[model samples]
Target: MKQGIHPDYHEVVFLDSATGYKFLSGSTKTSSETIEWEDGKTYPLIRVEISCDSHPFYTGKQKFTQADGRVDRFNKKYGFTK
Candidate 1:
């Protein structure tokens, strides 16, 4: 590791907006936002659109959809060819 050439790494709070789930981890990502954590300390806050808390695969709610628009043979099999 080199000194004075690396980005500042520190603890950060990642928030899942959809579920309001928050977890602590280290990151080099910087944010102007901050939040008071459950431990009564504040860290850099970053909001994400999706996280494991609300992701479909992690929640076992993923929809199994057939790929239906790219192949002519697939369309024919589904009686969508004209």
Candidate 2:
């Protein structure tokens, strides 16, 4: 496409704080923080709260919502007329 008008795409590391998992992938995101990977190379590091490693859905540990209980609580507190 257009030259000199697009963001630079480079290899970056995404670190998951919860699981301490690091993934190397290409992204347009830039950061001043850097870290030495297991391969003895330094790359831009991005700290993330959740990733596939720690995500509930991906790990199959997702919590189920109590829909009926929440509805009852809301009706009792607000006196919902219905």
Candidate 3:
């Protein structure tokens, strides 16, 4: 391990802006924003646009072409029979 060569790693709060979800984790990223978490402790706040809570894949909200009759359209385009 090297000294004075590593970024500061500390517990920070990641806030999902869309879902307003927040989680505490350690990271080397620095932020100028601060937030008081439920633990009554102040930590750096990082706002993110997407997280597990708001991600389509993680939340199972992903839309597949199978549901919108795209297969039928494809079949018609290719002159294939059902």
How close is every model to the real structure, measured as TM-score?
0.73, 0.75, 0.76
**What C-alpha lDDT does candidate 3 achieve relative to the native structure?**
0.93
Compute the lDDT of residue 64 as modeled in candidate 2: 60
Candidate 3 lDDT tens digits, 1-82: 9899989889999999999999999999979999999999999999999999999989999978676588888888999995
Cα deviation at 23, candidate 1, in Å, is: 0.7
Least lDDT summed over 10 consecutive residues: which range in candidate 2?
Answer: 62-71
User: Candidate 3 deviates by what RMSD?
Assistant: 3.0
Give me the displacement of residue 68 in model 2, in angstroms.
9.3
Candidate 1 per-residue lDDT, tens place, 1-82, comes to: 8899999999999999999999999999989999998899999999999999999989999864544345666777789746
In model 1, pairs of residues that clash are none
Model 1 TM-score on a 0 to 1 scale: 0.73
Worst 10 residues of 1 by lDDT: 63-72
- Please state the error at residue 55 of candidate 1 in Å: 1.4
